[model samples]
Target: MQAWGYVSHQIPLLSFASRLMNKLLAERDFSGQEICHVLLNCELQEGTRVVRAVDCRPYEQQGRSLRLQGDHDDDAEVVGIYEKYLSRPALHGELTYLDFLANWNTSKRDGRKWTRWSRQAKPRVLYYFPRYKSNPQHHQYDDFCRVKLMLAHPHRDPNELRKINGVEYDSYASAAEFCFANHQHPDDYYGTPNAEDRRPDPDEFEEEFHEPDLLDEDWLELARQLPDCPPSQEMVDLLGRRDIDIQYDWTPHVGRYADPGIVQGDYWRQRIAQNPLYMDVEDLPSEARDTLNAEQRIVYDTIVGHFQCESEEQILLHVDGGGGTGKSYLIKVLSSHLQKLARNRPSPIWRAAPTGVASNQIMGTTLHSLLRLPVDRAFTELSPADANALQNKLRDVRYLVIDEKSMLGLRQLSWIDKRLRQVFPARAVEFFGGISIILVGDFFQLPPIANKPLYFDGPLKDLHEASGQIAYRAFNYTVFLQKVQRQQGDDQASFRLALDELRGLKLSIESWKLLSQRVQAKLGQRDVDSFVLIRPMSHTLDPTLPHFKFLGKRSRKCSGAARESCGQWRAL
Candidate 1:
């Protein structure tokens, strides 16, 4: 009987209803209160109802005749409530009528009404079952049951009042479907405290129980009190588990939060674990260092000087150049040189780009993936625990290289700034958590999608744009690489000139002609044949390709062998 509280939703209401009715009939001599008590304690599933379509008939054919003979005209009364009162917009008045009828049908009656029972038992049957009264759909199901019982003829067999708990056309004809339509998710009902059963809101709690906002300074002061030695096993276990409640008021730290010291120590421990030895710095290849031109060498030395400087002042650097001017190559060499200097202390340089393709060029991850930034909205502050976790992950990082800087919008830059500030709260006021930032890209390339460009001077839309503006203005050093490194030989001079004109958006007549001559339409038959065909649709490209004529003459039917060869080209 105790299991009644945890009754499976898989059990059909019809089965429970029929079982209750049988128990009631068996205890006919007992008082109403006694029958209620007995039924509440009895084993369920006894005398379970099994519905069959053959047992049911339309009301007009058999129910009307049976109702008139048995004087069960009151059956029409409950069915009228379902159709008429439920349809009215004034639900308060109609529900009052339903409650009165339900009570009237269950009570002892006078004159033509039977004292023991109503001639129509549909209302009485529905009134007896109140186990699922708290379920939101229970009232709707009751009305459905009433309408179905009144419209169906079951040959006076109470167990066969209807075929299912819902309309015949509905998918809720099965028990699983019925439960899904009625009950909430199992986790909502069983895993957490029910809404009605939970404690009052924090505002309602006594003043002493309220949790004050523990500021960063307050957290730091608490951390300074801890001993400067190895953490005890107890501290290690506490740091490892996520479920430990750090905010719980306890002795020796009743007013302050308990986790900040633990989180800070864990962060420092991770940084110290990556200790770089003197012998780890390998000598760079002389050719790699010697290959840099005068312009490239100057930029390299400027960045290296900032890295080796004893001061904590952040180096906000911008390395600007056009395509094929060795921007990517410069970044690679800079990252390599910096890594050698840091000697194996984790990765002192972190590289990221706005796109996967661009990131692949620099052997880095996408900015969004690297920073775990949200794409759909501007960045928001992270929870303390989450910020601490991110801090631990990037503890040894000192330099952040952002490639494809032109594609990075105001909002994304703000996200990076806000995230770094959270990760290193000690330097919250510093730009990018005091880590030197290097931005490298051609400014004329693709701009950020669906957001204002980083250099936009228009009125700021929100805090993110304002923050990005401030961060952008903080760049004190810039290195411009104007010398074209990739296209240097005489054979590429014309193409290089044309690209320069295109990048500047001032293409001349000669440059236009040079670009046009390389188009597919101007290519010779030999050049066309050398090119591979990639189109999936053979017919679409048949007239375009000069080699199509080799397969067959335009006016004639091509041979099967030739057509097969053409089809293979199309597949390629």
Candidate 2:
């Protein structure tokens, strides 16, 4: 291990970040309660006990920080706490916490609360976690940054970034990372230089590096507006509601470097359910490929062929299976084919899911929420705000795998169709690749929701028909991952038997057992969940502009944390 000298604030930041990250992965939570317990103990056992519990990000020249993400001064009830408590160095990570006293002066005043608008306001933190940032370079390591930090854990109050076993300490722990890809690490030393080692090469850039420009207004404004990082529960609940799976990535270890670089002018085209999943032909086997029946191959061929082209157009795929069938398993398997085409790596067909739970499957939004349209108090069909929001994020996605298509109806089918058309010109454009939409679900398991379905009465009559224009052309491509997820005993025997049994009546396979056994020793439970929520990364940066900056990471995309691409921002 390299010997350390002192606990410069810069160094403490990284070690603290790494330790906290380790806890987030290990304990699966970042709340002060959970984090503080572990980090504090670790610090005490190791001996550093000084800590400053401030949570403010320097937003102004004098270091005034604004309310983090959710609290909005735009709303009134929360104005008091929002103004006083929100941006302070620390405040329970919320206006209030369990078993704690309320801190706002907007007390009952006369016992009875006032109006409806007043009820809407509260001193609660609004959470906003970004689902996916374009991850151009996650596999490469050339852009990693290093800093020092102490082992401390964060509590809701003073959520410090580092911690030890069960105590709180302040002395620096180890390395931390700060990134400025396209720029290298600053040459200035934060504190006194290491005494043992002689200064390296030529003119030391002593004056060149100093405290990071803490008063950059643009930088501060962006930080103030960054969507709040949502808690895990919010994320999981959202995805589960939409049937999206979830996964976490914590490899970078240090602070900002752990996740991929997300710039202001960008938005994620898809979710990062997991590092793209892959499949090896060696493991899948040619014999296995040969054994697939014609009907099965037809499904495979259409789906497998989608990636051969490059476009942003729309495509819809539908697969039907019976109860007990492995629709989800099949979705995963088929995803491999698409995954191979999506990324340059040899990993299996990747189905990048979302970190944030979403209401809508496509863009990590919710359903009822996404359905809001352009009608005001006048009445509209879908949510224009939501659609526009989605457009910016999903404009570039080429492949779409909609699991549970069997549960879809005509209205949804039409809504999605029309939406896709609106975004791209005649599907004939190669740049659109006729956006592929794969619908996988066991119709036998359940049918589409009634009333609002395509098969409903009223204005949606043409929607529910099997002979309508949509019926014939809805899913040009379809495949059934007929194999179940958890096929216990004899997989081949059971797979064949299950299909044979359902030959007449609807049937399905659950591939959980087989899948678990297949990668049990490798990936635990699951890492990548396709659930997502998206918003424009840069309110100012246009979606169409080509990559404008580079900081770290290997690829041109801003990734990792190096010291480059410093002056990349331009006012829109």
- Compared with the true structure, all predictions reach lDDT values of 0.57, 0.37
* TM-score of candidate 1 against the unseen true structure: 0.44
Off by over 4 Å in 2: 1-297, 311-315, 323-326, 344-389, 425-433, 452-473, 476-485, 488-572
Which ten contiguous residues of candidate 1 have the minimum total lDDT? 186-195
Clashing pairs in 1: none
lDDT score for residue 301 of model 1: 64
For residues 260-322, could you state the per-residue lDDT of candidate 2 as single tens digits?
Answer: 434432234334443432222222322343444444444555455434533223445455555
lDDT of 1 by residue, 24-142 (tens): 98877656666676879853334332111111223333222122233664542223323222233332322322233333332222213422224543222122221222233445444
TM-score of each prediction: 0.44, 0.29
Candidate topping lDDT: 1
Cα-based RMSD of the predictions, in order? 25.0, 33.0
